[model samples]
Target: MKVILVFLLALGINLVFAYLLALGFFYVAEYFFGVCLTVKEVFFLWVFLLVVAPLIKLKFRSEE
Candidate 1:
């Protein structure tokens, strides 16, 4: 349960980080890429968080 909680926390932090990064990208995008994100596209960050969450679990598993 603790590991699961850690995964959830990590996932949440990853999401917040992704959102802030994307928000910053918006400035560069508006100037150069001229691209803007929609709600669906924003969820792309989940793929990263999912992969990361499991990698963390694996890392600690060996320590135990």
Candidate 2:
């Protein structure tokens, strides 16, 4: 139960942090490149991938 609770909290925090990071990056891109991104689409895909991709790659590292 404790592990599941911690996992849920971490998941929520990661999602929100990822979304905010995406928002900031897109803002910078627009400032420099003059291309605008829709927040809904940007947050939906990139944020999910950003969080999951690293987890997939680092799956075994923590065991060391």
For model 1, residues 1-64, the per-residue Cα lDDT tens digits are 9999998987787666556665665567667887776656645644554456556567888899
In the range 1-64, model 2's lDDT, one tens digit per residue, is 9999999887777676566667777888789889888868786766676667457546757777
Output the worst ten-in-a-row residue range by lDDT, candidate 1.
Answer: 45-54
12 in model 1: Cα distance from truth in Å? 0.4
Highest lDDT, which number?
A: 2
lDDT computed for candidate 2: 0.72
Give stretches of model 2 more than 4 Å off. Answer: 39-41, 48-64
TM-score of 1: 0.50
Worst 10 residues of 2 by lDDT: 49-58
Task: List per-prediction Cα lDDT, in the order shown.
Answer: 0.65, 0.72
